[model samples]
Target: MLAEYRQFVLPRQRGLHAEIIIIPTGELKVNIKEKNNSLKAEFDELYFHSAGKETELVCRDQLGTESVRWHLHLANDDARELAMLIESAEEEFEALMRDL
Candidate 1:
């Protein structure tokens, strides 16, 4: 366990929303929800690509069925926190890769 993040929700189309949770093991536990319906997805490896004021969480899940490219609209403070979390996740990922 290296780092963990608190839950954050971002709105999507048609009342859908994305709930993002960063685990200590560098895995993103995501829950896409709308009303009473929800779907969960996990990404063990994530790439946070930033451009201008937008940031994208890039990852592909198993079965070749789930593709994730979450566009995050974060406030200034939230963006800073997210950046720190991403750095921690990247460090943990690198350590795990080296161990393999």
Candidate 2:
């Protein structure tokens, strides 16, 4: 919606991450959770947006389709704030790791 990203990362598990490319031709979407806990090491899909907090995480349902859980909207300042906090926590985690 704002700009185009060449490559993006998606999650499959608690510590697993998958790299994906955002096709500029289609609508941007992301799948966070796997159905029935059938995930192996990555999420159901990947998304491309948000510098860090300006993003959304979608959880698809209905078994084999692209539904949404955190789809974007006309406004998402609160959501963005939450995401920013998560990112900040991760950064702090990395700092902790370095300290350890």
Candidate 3:
């Protein structure tokens, strides 16, 4: 699979707690640590418009990787399904951002 959807709370570190929601892109590695009484997150993923435009989205063969990396190829109905996924994510994200 090209992507995996995962949501869970990160382990507590130092003095802070964190939560994470993984969005599809490739193999995501998230690390959370405490910093100044707050939470910090690190990952490999899609952020803003610059994401998903590089070799990160490429398949294992194309990337010459040891792991069997996956890639997505959407067409017609499949493309529509992707669109729906995005819309659904966006709707919830918008609600989340309302407090910002």
Worst 10 residues of 1 by lDDT: 36-45
Best by TM-score: 1
Better of 2 and 3 by TM-score: 2
Can you rank all candidates by lDDT, best first?
1, 2, 3
lDDT (Cα, tens digit) per residue for candidate 3, span 47-98: 2121332212222333334553333222234334434544455555566667
Poorest lDDT segment (10 consecutive residues) of candidate 3:
41-50
Per-model root-mean-square deviation over C-alphas: 5.2, 14.9, 14.2
**Candidate 1 vs 2: which has more TM-score:** 1
Angstrom error at residue 80, model 2:
0.8
Tens digit of per-residue lDDT, candidate 2, span 1-100? 1222222233223432322222223233332332222221113343325444444544455366676444332114534543444445456656766788
Question: Tens-digit lDDT track for model 1 on 1-100?
Answer: 5446354444224445556566645556656555444333354444466556555555655556566644344434455676687667778877887899
TM-score of every model versus the real structure: 0.46, 0.32, 0.29
Clashes of each: 0, 3, 0
lDDT of 2: 0.36
Regions of candidate 1 where Cα sits further than 4 Å from its true position: 1-5, 9-15, 35-44, 60-79, 89-100
100, model 1: CA deviation in Å?
18
